[model samples]
Target: MNIAKPNSYRSGPDDRGHFGIFGGRFVAETLMPLILDLEKAYTEAKADPAFQAEMNGYLKNYVGRPSPLYFAERLTEHLGGARIYLKREELNHTGSHKVNNVLGQIMLARRMGKKRIIAETGAGQHGVATATLCARFGLECIVYMGAVDVERQQPNVIRMEMLGATVMPVQSGTRTLKDAMNEALRDWVTNVHNTFYCIGTVAGPHPYPTLVRDFQSIIGNETKAQMQEIEGRLPDSLVACIGGGSNAMGLFHPFLDDPSVEIFGVEAAGHGLTQLHAASIAGGRPGVLHGNRTYLLMDADGQIQDAHSISAGLDYPGIGPEHSWLHEVGRVNYLSATDDEALAAFQLLSKLEGIIPALEPAHAIAKVLELAPKRPRDHLMVVNLSGRGDKDVPQVGDILRGKSK
Candidate 1:
């Protein structure tokens, strides 16, 4: 297999962590010191070869690395246009790509001499992943989740509990991911001495969006090598669902400079592009939220609007700052898939390819199905199957059963 030389995509988020005015330290004065400390620690750790080797060892033995690039022959034939490949991140130990970031963050936490870890989750995958690593590392873990998410994603909530993490349900705001994030930040501020805020996505303030993206970029780095081994060239296009945009950023970052490679980031269009969807880029305007200035779902009065989605993971009002910047520069295509469309793609993949995808990635699959038929048969397309659907089975079953009735 041949490897491509490093490209210009690495020079982003300049000295102040601003990705062309989209990202910065938009946090309280109390949190500023902690963020700066984390930035310094991460910068030092990143340059150490020992840190890289240790992270690699854990990724290999603990979290699993190089998730398969599967050629979906049946799906390809079913679509009858582009060749389809699934980057099977769902096969990871904790059942999602969320583990990839958590593993790295936990290691960083340890390096910083932090004895406790706190995080926020929407669908619960990140919470579960964080709890899993905390258990492995023998650290105290506290996860804040929205009350509505706690009720909807019970299976994952159970998994986090079973792994011995404290799960706090936040009932504030719209009772979803955004509220959970606010609660977690409050926790971080109160316990900054012994705590490390293990943010789950490529969002948050400075260094975090950049830090999480670097750790998760392992997805794209592996895909680059694996694709060259099998296809002998780069894929024509790549697709992944975006909430806070970790997995999508992981896959798209490596190919950003490759003008020949088209990238698509799918957001949830719950019912429509009206007030009831989580398509931040599609239906919202720019605003400051979660310590970053990104496109957000807000009302005319500038109050954050409630975002709805069948998929809890993609039900966010804002996206990662880098994704917001990318969308503005037109480097990547931003699209949306409705809940109904995601459900159809979820079922289609399960029946046709024996792959039950998480509803998050199902949105990308929905978009892929629409785009594939328009491209040539020889065109190669890769989609990041970010997580397994086991956590979503109960919810999906209820929906399907209702529809059947």
Candidate 2:
């Protein structure tokens, strides 16, 4: 089962849309025609400079491109190790890296003449981004969110409603992200003729993982130029939190071929990897779910297992197929952080740097706390601060007050 390695790490998902043995057009026969049509449209759009110009315009003025890469001086001093820089994606218009991808997809949907946009969300950042774009473009938007997430991410749910997007609460399965995606897919199939499904992450089938990564890759592209400007060289290491792995892939893909640069993707470990958790590559096996083959949590019987994490965004049973491929190819290191560790990291960043990071990136910061100190002071490390902590305030407050675990 040894897959030949690519000469350049960025070359991926051959014409059939696969990265090694992972990723493909795994879907219902009825959806194949639509998928093919979407792929063709994207291919054409990609080749059109005008299309890119329009997307770039929206990115700069609408979604706020070139998010700051700030030196986390206080945190670096507190840790006493590598000089750490935070890729501040939290400053984006929608308050997370999700907008970077949603903007591109929404533009494509419009180009294809789709009038309705449907999406699934876990922590609600994607939902907020989609709703914001739909509102700006005067298109109809519908978001499906797990009932549990609807309750936990109430602020974002409210924001979606404010933007005139209808939010549907999915109650099936674990009533979490996986279920929300299941419901979104069902709706997409039912309305495939007139609706466009705006996937929030680099998962799903075929072109989605590719297109989303390309859109989100802005993070890494900017980091590269910014680092060169500030440090006159590439950073020694890159770290980001992973759920469906869009943000991590966005930042890491640009550096995959840089032999001197190391990369790390941190998965939420919930209580621990030995207990209920969402560290797919660390604790799961190969399986197909949500239209792609990737590392998924399952029982001996092969039934998908529910994933748990204090942060709603990281509570998915599987990582993106690209992440699975990278893990197998040894191109990137995958690690995990427990709920308590992420919480402590969240509070520490707020206290030390005055930066309130979302729970997702806090998982990366938890690992950074240990890794940074072990590296030499001259070592350069960049961590993606993927979102703001405003949405997590209520939930974190409850947990800190012993109201919830």
lDDT to native, each model: 0.93, 0.96
Q: Kindly report which residue pairs in candidate 1 clash with one another.
A: none
> CA shift at 196, candidate 2, in angstroms?
0.3
Off by over 4 Å in 2: 1-4
Off by over 4 Å in 1: 1-9, 403-405
Candidate 2, residues 311-353: lDDT per residue as tens digits? 9999999999999999998989999999999999999999999
* Steric overlap count per candidate: 0, 1
Model 1 Cα lDDT, one tens digit per residue, 1-405 = 122333465578988988776888899988999999999999999999999999899889887777999999999999999999999999999999999999889999999999999999999999999999999999999999999999889999999999999999998998999999999999998988899999999999999999999999999999989999998999999999999999999999998998899999999999988648999999998899889888999989999999999999998899999998888777889999999999999999999999999999999999999999999998999999999999999999988999531
Candidate with best lDDT: 2
TM-score of each: 0.97, 0.99
The candidate scoring highest on TM-score is 2
lDDT of 1: 0.93
